[model samples]
Target: MAVEEILERLTRGVRDMDEELAAEAAQDALANQMPALTAINDGLVRGMNEAGRLYETQEYFVPELLLCSDAMYAGLGILSPHIQRAEEESRAKVVIGVMQGDTHDIGKNLVKLMLEVDGFEVFDLGRDVTPADFVAKVKETGAELLGMSTLMSTTMDAMGVAIRMLQQEGLREQTTVMIGGGPISQAFADLIGADGYAENATGAVREARRLLASRGAAVR
Candidate 1:
């Protein structure tokens, strides 16, 4: 099959939530000597982006989105190890998590996948992460970027608390903080003294790159 055809198959597999097809297409891409990054960004990510749009329009619900993510990750599992070390080198370290009291992590997981595809070394803290846990991870990893998300308005305050804790620990200056989720906005990010905000997973990757670049950090 042509490379374009293989990539299309990969995209279709994820968009259609077919894990087997996605894995098959991913293997084909590798056999064809296609760049793993290209397969991920142009294939899997594009499929996930379409799935996201479908969810936004209410054409797909959480179950469908989760299936799509599974298919995408199936492809990613095949492609990730093939990424060139040269591309991985100098990538910024990022710490990401959902705030305490918020168990909705679909958004956070999508952002984490996008960030990984963009070559960021991400340490996922998972959902319901406490402020102290986030601070501890940041300190332990010496991560240059910190990303937090919450789907609940009530738990939004935890983002600010995390930021304040980072400041108290003297880690705020070295970390570029970014926030997003259903209840999050640029205003909230600004209000919490965050370095950046994104409205969606793709935007999260863009914002992360821009924030890191502004800090003289190398981002591929």
Candidate 2:
């Protein structure tokens, strides 16, 4: 099959929430000698982005979104291993997690996938992560970027607490912090002294890249 045809299949598979089709198309892309990165960014990511848009418009809900993510991951499992690793050492490192007191992680998971596709070395701390754990991971990894999210207004304060911990550890100057989730806004980010704020997963990737570039750090 043509590269375009295979890529479209991959995108359609994810957008339609068909995991088997996505996996098959991913295999086809590899068999056709297509670059793994191209297949991911141009195919799976595009599909996931569309799914996100659908969710934003209320055409799809959390369940549909999760199914699409499953399809995307099905493809990713096949293509991710094929990504070139020669420049791995130069990629920026990111530590991401949902704040304490919140179990919502769909948004965080999407952001994580986008960051990985964009060539960042990601360490995901999963849901209900404590402020101390966030700081500890950043200190351990010497990560340049720290991303935190929360769906509840009550849990939002934990993001600020995490930032404070980073500051107390003297890691604030070296880490670029980004905050997001349903209750988060740019004003909140500024109030919490975060380096940036992202309203969505795509915005998260853009903000991450821009923040890293502004710091003269390698991105992509």
lDDT of 1 by residue, 1-220 (tens): 7989998999999999999999999999999999998898889988887887787788987788789989999999999999886655677889999999989998899889778766788999999999999999999999999999999999999999999999999999999999999999999999989999998787788888888878887675
| Candidate 2: tens digits of C-alpha lDDT, residues 117-156 | 6668899999999999999999999999999999999999
Query: Number of clashing residue pairs in every model?
Result: 0, 0
Cα lDDT of all candidates, in order? 0.90, 0.90
* Candidate 2, position 70, lDDT: 93
TM-score of each: 0.84, 0.87
Error of 1 at 128 (Å): 1.4
- Model 1, TM vs. native: 0.84
- In the predicted model 1, the residue pairs found to clash are none
Count of backbone collisions in candidate 1: 0
